[model samples]
Target: MTTSNRCVCPDCDWVVDVPVTTTEVFKCPRCGHRLGGGAPVSERHTLALALAALILALVSLWLPFVGYSASGVSQTMSLLDTSAELLHFHERLLAILVLFTVWVVPVLYLLAICWIFTRLLGSGPVGPVTLYFIRTVVQLRVWMMADVFLLGALVSLIKISGLAAVELASGFYTFIAFVVLQLWVANNVSRYQLWHRLPHQQAPQSEAGRAAHNQGLSGCVCCQAPNSPQHKKCWRCGETLSLTRWRGWRLTLALLIAAALLLVPAHVLPVMETTSFGRTQPNTIIGGVLELWQGGDAPIAIIVFVASLVIPVAKILTLLVLLYVAERGNDSTVKNRVVLYKVTDWIGRWSMIDIFVVAVLVALVRSGQLMSVYPGNAALAFALTVILTMLAAMTFDTRRFFMPTTK
Candidate 1:
């Protein structure tokens, strides 16, 4: 192997020897996680995109998102108004969650990116503040859900179109532009380049010590940088480190059990109850999918059924099996299992689409008796299920599966 650098795998803690002359991107030998890619992003371009994203976000939030009209009455919806409307209906928790994920988190994340880029691209010395900004940006990334909110709006538009006339507003188009810029910045931002540019500090562990530490090094879950085992937080991103390697089975197991329990009511109970022209009807997750299917929205129904129903139950089962396997000392197939873990982790976020739909419908359709929507108990239950499954995935330790069989 032609080699120039070596690093511990973030997922499995395998000591990987990277090839210097190879033309391909490096992936972890054990978990198949992408270690690094070709050519670092230029400081100038990354900074430009970050600044542009912030500007677009400001523009998007201020413009009216959409308009609804029926029975000689009309109303407008703005990006921030969704949370306000949700709050009016006494859905305090959903209101706060929407306010954070759709509005506050995205703005804070963009600001953090701009702050980091300003310092890293400037001639000024990057001290501990760089680490602070890096960590803040990482945490904010998970909470930012502007693009996801856009998808929810699309679903709501389709759902409400049959009952009322709908029109896209300036904010709707502006929000799409904001989402595009967000994606651009994410693709161009390079942690590898930024880490290299930060002021050099001595690794607490000597070269021999790092070698001896081997699989013991703590990897920053956010930036995936390997840090000394002695540190309480990541050196690169400052993310809190998980010190123990006992697999977090207790926490993970508890979350999975909670998620499984919630999943039952989530499917059985009504997710949305709508009243139109003095007639009331309730729709559960499966019932809504079938309703959509009967109404010639086979594609959309399939999407909702898979995202809200199939994915959650599948995630629960997959996590449970993996937990049992880990306890059984099956270290083989770590790579495939890690891949499964990634799928479960990423797909959990999309399950929020239904929750978003409920919020939108309740907000958009609330016009005294002629047409109105009230979220059923199942919406909260389903949302909680999504949250629990995501936590379970986060708490699970993939490294333990690859560790040598314990005596």
Candidate 2:
């Protein structure tokens, strides 16, 4: 329903007229405020586009992103081919990560989105099972990360502009489609609405259910508690907690620490050492940036340095500060704490700017021995560190950052 300079309350079906400037916020007249009363995503076209995206993604895997030729040898490379090349160069760890992030994970995420859209299309109120599916979709939204891969390709291209050449392939087009579909889905889907429609059941006063409830285990998103072992909602709050697939911050923290340690060596060591005839040169991230700067590419150098060096360090420090304050119960400055949380949350993924630059360089600079560019082990490790730490920060519950004022 189109509002004439007004916002409608989805809960009460009350249409409240608003001043033109207030169109940005959807405030209700009767109930005051509601978080998400946005448009529904039941459009037939979204589903069609989503399906098309999945097909394109599959085609991209088989087709090459671009073709390269050097020294009388020429070949086309798919996304998987790049990973294979990395593996061939004995960068086994990088190969595995690229395979997962670029080839496997995106595929799975798209497939899952397609399945969710299909289930939702046939629907009245989606059952508890579908509710779980919606949750999974939201969770996958955080980790899908195709844009980062695209960015890495872009970065790689700029690094070796003076050497070699690149030609676009069918796969690049498909990858672009994949990114568009993801953004579309994110805009249209309403997680709150999907879960809210499911029926609620109170938890039994029994000892087992009550104990589990107290321990934050019994209730989940879809079903009301006091119902059964399979009950979805809490007997108390009725707020949907993830019943089975709850994310663990502890494991995420460990992974981030391990990934960070690995990143130190990944950046310090040359990702790919180029050997032309008898001349050889190894390029670390710093070396690459310095070379770009000296060659009059100051803008690119600044961007790369900020993404590669400064952003990661800032993220690490921000997270450390948040964790420290939360642990110490420092409530003296609530506003500053909130500001830090917002900043940390927003900037966490900008680290992928370097990844984008890397991918572009790899695609553009494919001259084999004369000017070949390959993501060294450090690039892979550094990428993983960013991924892991971002995951850690997301799961770390910033609600804990704001110290409790009341005793």
Candidate 3:
């Protein structure tokens, strides 16, 4: 019930009091974004989970990942081979993307969480270093895609099982455990609790239960703490606060245009080339989907279609509509628009599933003469399309949904 429990919603800029002591889930009254409030997990417990996940991630890297046997020839792929093979074919950017999303980002995120929570469990004040790590955790959370990569791995295994004997290896189980623990740690580590534990300076006098911008305050994008307009850095987390509001929509528009332009090449060109019995076949995204469908793997084909085709195009179109709405100063469907933006941001990362599938196939199905999978031009183009659309969604400021468009 402390009066300092005031916060500005990052999504819609709604100001409300979210007591650190509350046990019920809190949502922004204006836009339905989760604002805080839940049964809090202990800092020590979160630290332990993070440490366990880190160990599993390391183990997964060292062990053999999967084994494939076909036509009396066999191959075993280590976890790193997914990216290493991509690099062997000169797909450096895609390789780096696969490596970071599946392994590096998750490990770094767990490390940051362990550091922050370990400090919180100690008897000392949370220092600047811990604060910085907390900021890192927030930013890295979205980019940690071990779970998506896991699904992609499963899909790759399914696609290849008919062609060969596929065996799950020790690293696969270890990675599954790591992904589960990492998700648990992510879910239980409450950002509100972390920010609450940090010491806060006296906030400038402003009424709670109103829009923060109306009172000459801006919400910290990193920590959601309301800051006075004059401050360039957040008082709580030291994140830079943007003074301008319109730049976000402009940047979002530019990125969307780039992504839209890339979609044509992504769909038209071959994503991966398959060679079997000395004959080569090239497949585009849609062509692959049709192949999977005709091959009786309709479920996976639908997944690939939705993730690779429908989602990206839908996201771009939806974002374009949102930009139009923001430009026209429409506020009637503001809540709906905010919800759409959230969904767009959340699902954008899943589009990379196809890219991961290609990486896995390229690495695992390397039997020369009998069969082989090679990275194609469309793989990079499609990857870039997904990335650009994701960036566009991130650049889009949801607060624009609530703000008035100026002439």
Candidate 4:
């Protein structure tokens, strides 16, 4: 059989015929995935956007998402305040996760992008490490997770709609804009070009290495070292590093179904209970938002509604649709599947907004039990639902949507 002389561009998905002459450099015709081209950024642009993303991230951490008022009690929470609260309430895990996802990771990623852009603006090729850094930034781009927080916030708002008095804060809008800029920058930066410009180091040749490489069977994708080609396990790490797609569908499906079952009680049970003077009222998500609205914080009501209710459910539904399409091998659903995949991927992290809001309130809204905030069990369940469903959705294979229709 003749060799199938074609290669696929990992970045842009462009397919090109490999030239018969090995001397000719094969490049992607669409993205020009060769070497020696700088990204479309000037030093000034890189510095400016970096500064903006940094500023926005910092500002978001210190501003109030919404103000809470009940029975003549009132307060506000900033992002950092919430993180501190999470640590205080023994929810340190979620708080740390929030801090890194919302505060630290985005800032670091943007900084890395800026550093690379500033160094390579008009200069030539960068070093291999820097190129690795660029690839890392690209890897991290989708996982930054602002949208997930947003969705969670919306879901929480909708759930709280009927109960509490809530009002929007300046920080809420700032956070939204922060998510937008991150997405804009990530989408605009071409990874293919970025990787092409970075220095490429060929694997060092050795007698044994050459013999293993020439045998052309199995190895690590990262180090290009050969392994047990016969046994389907890497000799070095005992890892199955062959080109095998993950095969955990039964397990993933079981966990997801379990989470889906828990989602019922998570939403049905009370998430928060408030007491004032001698009166006590248990609040579901719907009740809280209505209380906030009736208390004359209409904007906050809307913010809470959108961030906590609408977005989370939307994200969940999006994920469900994608999973269904993928599992069924529905080629006709490919476009919709892709759209849902993008949506779920982009917004998975924003679900943390409710977690942040709760965390901050639990930390800062303390008044010696006279007026205090604490997370209820349902809050934990709800948070878990959002997190688990998002993860399940992510583990779903979208490429299945593109497979040939066999059934």
**TM-score to native of every candidate shown:** 0.89, 0.74, 0.95, 0.64
Backbone clash tally for model 2? 28
Worst lDDT run of 10 residues, candidate 4, spans 202-211
Candidate 4 C-alpha lDDT tens digits along 1-407: 21223333322223334333233345545434431223354457656777687788888877787676656767776767656766676666676777776668888888888777777765765765565566568546645766656654554444334445767799888988888887777666654444334222322222331223234433333222334445565332233555324423444465477667766766677666555454666666666668778877787667666655676667666655555556574445545566666666566555556565565456445443455566656677767766676666555644345434322
Q: Candidate 1 or 4, higher TM-score? A: 1
RMSD after CA superposition, every candidate: 3.4, 7.5, 2.1, 8.3
TM-score sort, best first:
3, 1, 2, 4
Residue pairs in clash, model 1: none
In candidate 1 the C-alpha lDDT for residue 77 amounts to 74
User: Over the full model, what C-alpha lDDT does candidate 4 score relative to the true structure?
Assistant: 0.57
Give lDDT per model, in order: 0.74, 0.58, 0.86, 0.57
Evaluated with lDDT, which candidate comes out highest?
A: 3
* Local accuracy of candidate 1 as per-residue lDDT tens digits, 1-407: 22334455656765555544444677775568776655666667877877787887888777888888888878777777777777886778888887787778877877878888778767877767777887677566666677778888898888778767999999888889888888777666655445545433543432321322354555556655567767778665566766444348888999999999999898899987888788889989888788778878888888888889899989999999988886455556665788888988888888888888887777777655477788788887898998899888878987767655422
TM-score for candidate 1, please give it: 0.89
**Candidate 1: stretches off by over 4 Å:** 1-6, 17-24, 199-201, 204-217, 222-230, 235-237, 242-247, 327-332, 405-407
Q: Using alpha carbons, what is the TM-score of model 2?
A: 0.74
Superposed model 4: Cα runs more than 4 Å off: 1-39, 55-77, 122-125, 145-184, 199-248, 289-333, 347-350, 368-370, 405-407
Q: How far is 338's C-alpha from truth in model 4 (Å)? A: 3.3
